[model samples]
Target: MPNTQQLQDLTTQVRRDILRMVHKVNSGHPGGSLGCAEFFVSLYQNIMDRKETFDMDGIGEDLFFLSNGHISPVFYSVLARSGYFPVNELNTFRLINSRLQGHPTTHEGLPGVRVASGSLGQGFSVALGAAETKKLNHDKHLVYSLHGDGELQEGQNWEGIMYAAANNIDNIISTIDLNGQQIDGATDDVLPMGSLRAKFEAFGWTVVDIEQGNDIDAILTGMAEAKALTGKGKPVCVLLKTVMGNGVDFMMHTHAWHGKAPNDEQLEIGLAQNPETLGDY
Candidate 1:
């Protein structure tokens, strides 16, 4: 079993992976991807009961869906590091016909990616369907999903939230990356969905909060708690309050980096802030 220290190192490495992938391509979303590095690392390394080989059906293993697929850098890093594919493939990020696209898609047959989540708000619906499928198949595995806080404004998420709870779909845990920043500007400046915790609770789902979404230990513990809360009678929601550009000095506290790639000098600065934990990809 990996310890907290290992998880921290993995998180740091994933951050490095995110920065480098985006820098190399001069495209891809790094801010949200960086913000979610710790969560993705913890989920793949500690939470999910995954298989050694890829299975599209995921018959007997935990399944994960990326609701905000723009954060593909972090997802791709974790999946590659988790043995889903070669770590070197990250070099193809955003290139023509690359599996590691600006957003993840099953069309490329990427091993760890299950859904094509680019349009936003649809992945939550797809995750709920996967949870329901698990119930019908009598599979005891859980389905996990991550959504952007701004994406909640899309309206379809509420329908999924209401549907999961009314049906008692307790096998799924949907997490909102509550970084408070999106592409255009801060979520508040754009369109704020106040009190996500209360919102989910009102929708009949149980809610857990990780006030420090960048902290590795908190994520590991909170995820464990979320898993325990599952298999009961309600779908669980995690409000992960992360910094938009976590681990980078200049990247934090702004929405400008949401979809923008860092230049060479800026990339150097970001890498210096993160150091070289477990080496770059």
Candidate 2:
């Protein structure tokens, strides 16, 4: 497991990567990426069953899926920083021929990624399928998935949730980036996710809540609890409460910055709040 200082550094680096990648590409999502940085860093550095060596089948390790593929910047940064690939490859994010597309895909044969996800709400089912396959193989490794609050509006997600609970796929743990704001506006303003915790409970899944979405320690603790709750014949869901653009002040409270790239001046200001701990990509 990564030490506290290393985890903090990793999260800072991931946030920097999110900003730099989006500014370079001029067209990737940053709001969600920034908000989810700590969670991704904590997972790769402390929680997930990942290593420098990766296998497509994940024979003896845990798996992670990004259902809300729009947050690719944070996911790609975390994967690279975790040694899935060279950190320098992050410079090619969203470029013409780069494996780091606007969204993640196994089509590029990326070592760490197993599924192609961009269409939203599909990853939950993909994760469930992988978990079920692990059961068939008698593998004890678990599967984890992340979904956007807005993506929950997709009908496929409910289907996946029902399937996982009905079949008692207890080895999977899924989290929602409950930043309360999506591309359009506040989640409550756009489409209210009424009592998400209660909804999951009513669906027969155990639910946990993490109040501080940007804090690495809090995220780690919540994940540990969720993991412990697993294998008792119920899947787990973490309702993570986060701000849309967590680290950057200007980007934080509005939907305007959801997919907007910061100009040079804006970049400087944003980076000021999150100092460079690990070297920039």
Candidate 3:
């Protein structure tokens, strides 16, 4: 297991990778990716029960799915740095013919990723299916999924939520990256996720809140609590309060940076706030 300092360093490196990769590609969502950096780092580095050797079936091991696939930079960085692939492969991110596409896919046989999830609101259903399969196979490991706050506007997510609750798919922990911004605009302006906690609670999910989604320690503790809440014959939902484009001053407090890559000057400014800790990919 990685120590707390190592996890912190890994989170920093993942943040650096998010910026560098997006800056290199000149296209990709940095806001959400940066916001979820610490969460992903903590999962891949310290929390998840994953294996070095990839397995498609995910039998006897934990599984994670990225519902809002626009955050591919952070996911790819964490996976590569977690020994899923070569860290140098990050240079090919979003490039033509690269396994690391703008959105994550299992088609390229990516070792760590099992689903292709650019379309929003599908990950929850997919995670429920995985959980059901785990029960069918008599496996004890859990399934995890992450969704965007704005993405919850899709109707399929509600259907999945209802299905999971009704069917008692309790071995899955679903998280919402409640950064309050999407590519088009603010979530409230676009379609406010009014009282998401209450909404999930009404849906029969055991809801938990993470006040500081950007902090590694806070995220770790929240995830541990979320894990404990699982398998109680109810689905778990974590409403993660995260700042869009966290750790970068100019990128925060606005939705303009949601899908925009930082220009040369802005890139330098963003990088200044997040120093290269474990060396940029």
Candidate 4:
């Protein structure tokens, strides 16, 4: 198992990968992807019980779905670094006919991706279905998913939330990146979904809050807690409070970088903030 420092190094490397991938394409969502680096690293490295090889069925191992797929840069980085695919494949991100599309798609037969998820708010339902399948098949492993807080504005998520609790899909853990900012502006300004914690609890799911979502140790600890909550008759929800465009100084506190790639100077500054640790792709 990787120790704390090793995980931290990987997280830093993943952040570098995100910045480079987006900057290369000159088109991609960097803000949310940067914000989720730690979560993805901690998850694939420490928290998950993954199989030796990749398979779409995920019969006896933990399954992860990226519902907020616009952050494909982070997801693809983690998967590759975690041995799901070639790390150098990251150079193909957002390129024509690459498996690493702007949003993850199964049509390319990507090893780590199970669903096409650029369309927001659909992950919860998809995760619920996988969780229910695990139950029926008597698979002891879990299903995990990540959602953008802003994506919850879609009505389908509430339906999935209600379905998960009502049907007692307790083996799934759904985490929301509560970064506050989205494409339009802050989620509140665009379309306020008040008190996600309250809304989740009201729906009868158990919620775990990771107030320091950017920290590696915090993500591991909080995710371990979320894992422990599995099989307890309620679906688990982790509300991770992250900063969109985390790590880069200029991009840290706003939604301006949501879907924009950094220019040459900006990429240099951003990469300097997160010095390469595990070597860049």
lDDT of each: 0.91, 0.89, 0.90, 0.93
Candidate 2: clashing pairs of residues: none
Q: For candidate 1, lDDT tens digit of each residue in 104-127?
A: 999989999888998999988999
Candidate with more favorable, higher TM-score: 1 or 4: 4
TM-score, predicted candidate 4 vs. hidden true structure = 0.99
lDDT of 1 at 158: 92
What are the per-residue Cα lDDT tens digits for candidate 3 across 29-144?
99899899888988888888977899899898999999999999999999999899999999999999999989999888878999999988899989999999999999989999
lDDT of 3 at 193: 72
Cα-based RMSD of the predictions, in order? 0.9, 1.0, 1.0, 0.7
In the range 127-175, model 4's lDDT, one tens digit per residue, is 9999999999999999999999999999999999999999999999999
Regions of candidate 2 where Cα sits further than 4 Å from its true position: none
Quote the lDDT for 244 in model 4: 92
**TM-score for candidate 3:** 0.98
Worst 10 residues of 4 by lDDT: 43-52
Residue 155 deviation, candidate 2, in Å?
0.6
Q: Give RMSD (Å) of candidate 4 vs. truth.
A: 0.7
For lDDT, the strongest prediction is: 4
Each candidate's TM vs. the true structure? 0.98, 0.97, 0.98, 0.99
